[model samples]
Target: MKAAVVSNAGPDWEIREVPTPTPGPGEVLVRVRACGLCHNDVLVGQKRFPFLGPGPIITGHEAAGEVVGLGADVRNRRIGDRVGVPWMQGSCGQCAYCATDTSLTGQTAMGCASPRTTGVTVQGGHAEYVVASASGTVLLPDGLSYEVAAPVLCAGYTAWSALTDAAPGPNERVAVVGLGGVGHMAVQYASACGLETLVVTGNPEKAGTARELGAANVVTSGTELAEIGGADVIIAVTPSASQASEALQGLRRGGHFVVSGIFPDGSLDLGPRSTFWARRQRISGSTHAGPARLAEALDLVASGRVTPMFELFSKDRIEEAVTELTRGTSRFRAVITY
Candidate 1:
């Protein structure tokens, strides 16, 4: 099978032939239809901080495909099942965190070093076929196709997982910082939950994009952000570490700031009272939405409530997609379709 493989930590991708493997016990072989190119791919390729790798790894996580074969012990899913493989592969349930149903909490995802995934390392869905553990495989409804469902595996899932930490009520004001892949979906999800949506982005173009995606108001960085002045919940989806930390000041008394963006190594300067004052604001982060949350994300998309705006790219043009994205030409998410 032809796969996009990273031969070494560099600034390019190499297309090479790799041996296709059969499904092992409790595993499924998915004929990949599409995969989303996330920011993490750039980090992994450049060997950025927090990307633990000295070796090459297949760098895709958001994938949707059809299961053509299954292992002998896999019983929960059947052949021909259309499944969306989330960033989470599967976690060892024996851990203390898993015993508390934290897996159900949309945390504890499988890493590249997992046992049931593909490649020598964690081979993701950047290839013709991918081997995924049957444990965390969530079935996509029949109506959704692989092309449209691909981004939901990561962007949509991450938005939902972070929003879970900020359950803004109808009366609360919700601010979504950075109208990128995950932030765009965060606006839609916040709107669906009946919160007043305000989008904050440094780019003015994204402000218009945010408004079109259900955000009632959009605020650029230059403005005073009067529309969402006292936001009860602020979800920072920008990959700017400084912005993520400073977002804690945008919340109301007793409000929460959920930081999920993975920016480069950096720091933030905020007031000492941001967390200690009467507001008693809190901050948390999430990796990606787990099984049930992914199901919810799909349902939201299917219902026409949350639509992921993405630019589609062919598998051969993977490099172009990454470049276009980093250059800010591609507006929302980018997907590599087969």
Candidate 2:
């Protein structure tokens, strides 16, 4: 099997032939068709994030592929089923966090934890083949394609889960900060949920694109936060924690700010003035959608409500893709197609 191996870990990626991965008990081997390149993968690979994916790891998590084989104890998931394997590969299921919500707890944390994950610590997507647990695989709906479903596994789920509070209603106002991976998806999901979406990006170039993605309004950081700009929910998808905190002032009282981005270093300053004084303002965080919610998000994609903005790259083009994204030259999303 050919994989975009991290090599020795750094800015570049090496696409090399590696032994084919096999499914273990309760696991399945997926012939990966497409894998989403997320910013989180970059941070983890470079060892800049809180914990680098255990090492000697492949660095993709948002993947969609066909199940070519199954492990000994795997059932329900058929051999030929096409599934979207997310960053959260699988969980203990019996853990207290799994019983509540995996997003709120770290028990099911994949991609960057001990016990590892399919691509990162365990081995990930970005390869021709990968392994995943039956519990973690979300069956792609009838009309969804692997390329289209790939990014939804991670970026899409993060945005959807953050914007919707697990459930968003019509007529709601949602504010999305940053127009990168999670931010772009956030705009689309907010629109799909019937909210008036507003985007806040520091870059002027993203203003038009943000509006195109479903944001009713778009403003650069230099621009004044609109007077009636308050939203029912403010999602900080920006990597800068401070910018997210500024978004809080843009939200109306009783609004919630959900942070999808994890600042590798500095904290988003949530000053005491507005963070606590507001009647219903709350600070919440959502990691990724669980299996059921991940399924729901894929359904959102199947409905055409949200489309991932991805640029396809071939195996040999892994280095270029990484460089472009690293240099901030790529627009929207980037995907590696096998």
Candidate 3:
């Protein structure tokens, strides 16, 4: 099998032939069709993020493929079944967090007792073949294409889970900060949920695109969002912790603020004006979505209510795709097709 292998934590990826992986007990071997390149993968390649597995790793988590082989004890999936393997590969079903909330607890249980992560702690989907746990694989809808479903496994699912956690009611104002892949998806989801959507981006150029994605209003960073009209829920998808804190001011009293982006470094600065004395704002962090939310996100995509704008790339162009992702030059998500 041919795969894009990273020898170390640096900005380099090499295409090489590797042995095709076999499924273990309760696992399924998927013949890769498409993989979505995420910004966290770039951070892992650059040695900025923590890598739990060995070197010469295959890094790609958002992947959609067909099941080619099923291992012993795997009963839920069979060969030729289409599935998506996401960042939350599988989690320990026995952990306290998983015991309490099975919906959005995989990210917290990662690297713990019995959780495994794709493209980080395991051989990921940036190859022609990869093995995944049958229980963790997201079953693709009938009409969703592999390329379209790939990015939804990560970005779309994350956005959906964050919105679910916030639990915004109909006609409530939802503000989305940062107009990246996740932010754009949030806009579409918020609109589809019957909430009035607002986009707050530093880039004025993204105003038109944000509006097109279903944002009823677009405002700059310095705008007094709370003064004019506060939002019932504010989703901070930006990578900067400070920016996430700044988004708190946009939230109305008793509003929920969800932080879904992975920041490189630096602590969150929620000053007195942001979440102090009189401000009654609730802040929470979110990562990749769990199985239930992933299914919901896929259903939304299948219904054509939400869709991702992506640039397609082949295996040979993996490096170029990573470059475009890091440089923030891609129009939206970058997908690697087989």
Best by lDDT: 3
lDDT (tens digit, per residue) of candidate 3 on 76-100: 9989999999887676667776676
Superposition-based RMSD of candidate 2 using all C-alpha atoms, in angstroms? 2.8
> Which candidate number would show the highest TM-score if scored against the true structure?
3
Check candidate 3 and list the clashing pairs.
none
| Global CA lDDT computed for model 3 | 0.84
State the lDDT of candidate 2 residue by residue for 173-250, as single tens digits.
777888887788888988877778888888887887887898888776412454765776778888887777677777
Candidate lDDT values, in order? 0.75, 0.76, 0.84
Model 3, position 236, has a per-residue lDDT of 86
lDDT of 2: 0.76
- C-alpha lDDT of residue 55 in model 2: 46
Candidate order (lDDT): 3, 2, 1
Candidate 3 backbone overlaps, count:
0
Q: What is the C-alpha RMSD of each candidate to the true structure, in Å?
A: 2.9, 2.8, 2.0
Q: Which stretches in model 3 have alpha-carbon errors above 4 Å?
A: 93-104, 272-277
User: lDDT value for candidate 1?
Assistant: 0.75
